[model samples]
Target: MGPKTYSWPVATFDPLILKQPRWILAIVVGVVITLAFVRLGFWQLDRLDERRVANTTSEARMSEPGRPREGVLGEHGQEVNEMLHRATSVEGAFRTADEFFSPGRVVSDRQGTLVATPLDLADGTVLIVVRGIVPPGTPGPPAAGFEPPSGSVALVGRIDDGEKPIPIGEHVPEDGHLASLSRVDLAYIDRWIEGDVLPITLILEEQTPPDPGGVPLRIPREELTEGSHLGYAIQWFSFAIIVAVGVAVLVYRAGTRAGPTEAFPDGASRL
Candidate 1:
């Protein structure tokens, strides 16, 4: 019979083994990546905080009683951001000739176009109003069935800021009397409008003597819910943990695979 063979177990988990230069580099890289992921997680947390504050402010502003448009604007116009979502009342006559369409607005998963019109206030200034959403494919101005009521009108609406303008090439037609605009940018619209244009847009909530046809659907108030920032933060933190675990696993495998520095028979004696 062959003599029984026995060997000592290698020290696979020795902390000293990880002191090698290669392992040190791996650890440094892993730590850097982990810290980056942690930073991303914290960044998401910060975004969550900002969102909460904004939501709170909006809710508070929206719940208050409506104020006169002039009062909201003050002697010198207030920053649009500070007044956003505040309810206000205005009286003006619709300048239907200068109307434009803002396409690609989606409501409740249904696509539609927003009818943007210039309202000539009594003071001779123009206020941009997003009246409501219309069916897709509706024509721009002087459109049949979608015409806003003629003559002076009173409006109750929430204050809103304009959107970023679509680049020249991207706007539909890109020519005289634009049929549709990519967004509700008042600064861009001011170029074509005849009078001074208000910096903010009014998202129309109520119109006196409602449109007889009711063709354009009234846009609902925006729903305020905490977004997915928390989930993203968790995901980033989980990635950091996973990277740490992966680095630990790789280090353990490297140490184990390196084998022992010395091996001895079971009965052998060491000096």
Candidate 2:
């Protein structure tokens, strides 16, 4: 007998197969996931733009000549965010008796505490001044010379806003002063100061009369830099593309595979 020939069914993809309920559901799910990832990428881009604008504003404000305390605070209705990082000077006497400390502060990678003291401004409005960073464990008054200078003094600092208050459990008071705080939440510190306290605080940069001992180390101005937003955006965009291509490949494979009712042999249909 002559050599026998065998016939085998060949796989073929049909676009109509994608219309089936399962494929349709898969396609819809894939599309939704892809769109969500794309939206997240754009959100990160928006964050980047905001950061850039903030950096520009900070650079411009910090470079200009320092404004007097009144000039910085006199602008009616100006929010603390708007004035942040701007250079300003104020003449006041430190109310040492009411000083408190914010622990877990870091300067040059060294753990420390921020000495927060209320300054009696010339206009009678109290201003919270973050004198500087003291050793981590130093509580109430910073041990002698590190104490806020006595009498009237002039100070130069950058404008900063108060931090949001944390749970009261972490902010217990001690002898009219807080031994430590999680942040400089002025609202909680307001109890120690008399009269109206400004909504902002100063990151003390310089004082007319320097403390010879320099117990509390001066903190450097924070450097502005774009964070991981761009990288995160790229990752999200990549995920979207991957999901799109993966879905397409899966649909093609599924459609080409054999189904219950399909055409196999030439001009013949499988039962």
Candidate 3:
């Protein structure tokens, strides 16, 4: 090869920028704002990905075979939080005497209440199980014809995060009627039972001695509604691009504009 040629690095920033010192401030501001918007767009996309993964995992877990209640739940409880919505089986007797009614739950478009009863395990640990839903037509107190099975029972249900606390005061359940609990919050469950209780709730899928007519089997339904995060991310990125394009147009205008003129001129030149 002839003398080794050295390729000089190309200048990325505008060379004419030094001539128009004021443009330095505009460019800096534009870059900062653009970066901020771009980062926000990426953050929203990350959130979208996380939400999608969570929903998909939950759906998959719900469909797969359930794990043993003791193995997953353990003694400390709420250990396998990532396994939410996973199906599981429990062997215990329903404590109908301390049955709780979660008010204002809707199923299949019709409004109703969820029957939450404690399942006293052999190891003395109490688990709150949401047995099923009572239809809107069913009257309160005794839940019409619905009653939990007597003696030992085996249940299959999907794992659930205990209900979020609703704004409601404590109300004692009557002798025959189920207690009107505003939500299935663990704090509320503690009020109904003594000592430590399981931190999760099971939405009844299959229960022995079926009462199909009395309490309809409430299967867990997945909410597949994709949120507007993707749209929001697009909007942010578009805004950043628009701002960048505006900066480019500004630089182009500066390059093409005529040279600066004198502020003051002689009388002859003024004419």
Candidate 2 lDDT (Cα, 0 to 1) = 0.81
**Best candidate, TM-score:** 2
Candidate 3 structure lDDT: 0.74
Estimate the TM-score for candidate 1. Answer: 0.86
Which 10-residue span in candidate 3 carries the lowest summed lDDT? 262-271
TM-score of each: 0.86, 0.86, 0.71
The superposed Cα distance between candidate 2 and the true structure at residue 258, in angstroms, equals 7.9
Please report, as a residue range, the 10-residue window in candidate 1 with the lowest summed lDDT.
169-178
Task: Output the number of the lDDT-best candidate.
Answer: 1
lDDT of 3 by residue, 1-271 (tens): 4443333233244457547768887888889999999999999999999889987887787678877787666642656576588788889887777776766788767677777788888888788888777876566434668877688888888888787875665566665343677777887668557646877878788888665347654745657655998999999999999999999778766665444453332232332
lDDT per model vs. reference: 0.84, 0.81, 0.74
Q: What is candidate 2's TM-score against the reference?
A: 0.86
Clashes, model 2: 0
Tens-digit per-residue lDDT, 117-153, candidate 1: 8999999999998888888887656555888888988
Winner on TM-score between 1 and 2 is 2
Report RMSD for candidate 2: 5.0
> How much does candidate 3 score in TM-score?
0.71
